[model samples]
Target chain A: MSETPIAAPDPPPGLSELFLAFASMSLAGFGGVLPWARRAVVEQRKWLTAEQFNEAFSFSQLLPGPNIVNFSVIFGSRLRGPAGAAVALAGLLGPPLVIVTIFAMLYTRYGDIPWLQGVLSGLAAAAAGLIIATTAKMAKPLFEKALATRSLDAAPLVALAVFFAIGILRWPLPYVLAVAAPVSIALAWFRR
Target chain B: MKGDGDILLTLAGHFALLSLFAIGGANAAVPEMHRVAVELRHWMTDRQFADLFAIAQVSPGPNVIIVTLIGYQAAGLAGALVATLAMCGPTCVFAFYMGRTWERFREARWRNAIQSGLVPISIGLIAASALILALAADRNWVAGAVTFATAAFGYWTRLNPLWMFTAAGLIGLAGYI
Candidate 1:
């Protein structure tokens, strides 16, 4: 979504560093990768600055895939070229892929077991908590910036309102989106 | 009766259509996934679907990997492979190939307008999905409390998420097998 500023390309980070950085982030990823990803790429490794991260993130958001997976490809490509992108993709996905594959296998074998099913129920609730928590943590900066600009404006507020009305209130989602989406965007245009 | 292959084909058609509508991510299409899994195919019971989702939730990678696991159970190895590739392949190709070209459209008035419009749509979908997940997965007061408390804690506090998971683990220990 950003217009490119004219400048020479930044030098690529080394392969080893890319691998190590992704590994660090992956291991630390608790509720989700966003927190660890923020710590690793922006705070610790200095692979990309905050401005660059946001630009890549916008593109990631625009893409029709998981944002974190897209971030792996975009950030890795920027930091290490095609090979770096490949490495980042593999590193980021490798653990989960392997683990899921194994779990899928075991699940196919043992999933009908009643005890296993009971355990998964509790775990699933926990997963919901995890997802909500992670989204909350990521939302802080957006919330802070909105308050700082003294713009308790409609856009972000509407996004949250739309979310609450649909999520908590159980409004039909398509109707909620149809009504709220344009209004939220218009709020942004006005703020600009 | 339709051959097993035909059932797989039917599931594939469902996923393919769902794939196109997945604007936000793998996570975005989940409510539809639940609809199909529960209402359409009858491949699983509701509790089973909720459990599959939970396992997917705790795992790394994309949230949709559970689709594969569910598919495998319903149809076998081919089902797993078909569901995995079908769920992810279209979106990945769209991103990897057309991503840069998309950025060029950023300057267009309607393009900007579309994004502005899309933001709320996506948010709505996400919230709906989260709520569906909560309803389907949360079976008890303990589970409900964990979800609410965790969400509030995550939103308002700076607690390490790992610690939260640890707390959940303790809760799980009390109730889970």
Candidate 2:
């Protein structure tokens, strides 16, 4: 993947620039911010290669907390240090927090009307559907790996087991993860 | 009723704990959030929880803003600030440290194995989250149909999701759902 180097390189952004970049990304991101973040960091700023961005994002996704928030922290820390990380996080979340708080106030004031409730319900249904679509897209890589190998992979099985245990059975999360994470890791280690 | 300080502290503490388990993102913690908000604390009803999630989904920025909404509902603006800070703070520190060290382990076998293992589990958690949200949101046959259609559209087409969200909201406003 790294066989061919790009022809030109851009200077890495300073901390203030990083803050502005993430703040704008968050501001423009109406439904999801990850796509906007990728565009800004990889495409516009050229801070990281596309491959590097994917790696950082995947690593961030594997960690706790929100994915984009984690990405902001990781990317900022890579550029500078704790201060940069804090700056990036504040950039990404500060504006959204204010906007969402305003929304909360509006909803509380007018949420009791029947028509607004109906709209919210409809929006909720569509939002649920979007989540399902996102899940399928996220799982596609595992399914493709299993297909290419022409063998039933343990990863998909482990995933299904987790789905059934929590999604179907309604088990508490910590207990399920306590068992599933280690088992999945062991299986991968053996397979490797 | 609890004091403002007490409410803010509790909000901060609970979200900080949940932050650790947010494997695939804050969405992965929805069911647990539901349990805590609706069942345990009586902060809101199931419908209110679902509606707040929808608001977060439709709003700009990250979907985790639902935590902010929950905090707002529980203890006003102070609760919101505390919840968001708690949710993002500890995990951001972890990510910062890990990012610094991650390149050092670029070729490490154990790192690769751990990454591969966590991918599927993260996908599973997201699926569970989708299921929980779907159950909460799909209240009627029309709502169910809207959800199914939206999923199909999202999967099959590269169209912007905002269109679907707008369409659904309009449908609801028109009393279709």
**A181, model 1: CA deviation in Å?**
7.0
Error of 2 at B5 (Å): 3.5
- Residue-level lDDT of model 2, residues A1-192, one tens digit each, is 222222123455677998999999998887779899989988998877898788788788878889999999888766666777888998999899999999899888998899999999899999999989989888888999999999999999988988888788878777888899899989989994
Candidate 1 - CAPRI tier? Answer: acceptable
The 10-residue segment of model 1 chain A with minimum total lDDT is: A1-10
Give the winner by TM-score. 2
TM-score of each: 0.75, 0.93
Per residue, candidate 2 scores C-alpha lDDT tens digits across B111-161 of: 888888887888887898789888988989999999999998998899899
Please state the interface RMSD for every predicted structure, separated by commas.
Answer: 4.0, 2.1
The superposed Cα distance between candidate 2 and the true structure at residue A162, in angstroms, equals 1.7
lDDT of each: 0.66, 0.85
> Which tens-of-lDDT digit does each residue in A1-192 have in candidate 1?
334411113566677767777766765564357767877777876666677667667777766556776777767765555777678766776666567767878876787776665566657676676566645544455567778889664556765776677556655434555567567656656655
Residue B6 displacement in candidate 2 (angstroms):
3.5
Chain A: TM-score in each model: 0.64, 0.86
Where does model 2 exceed 4 Å of error? A1-12, A144-150, B1-3
On the 0 to 100 scale, the lDDT of residue B27 in model 1 is 63
Show where candidate 1 strays beyond 4 Å. Answer: A1-28, A43-45, A75-88, A112-115, A131-192, B1-4, B104-109
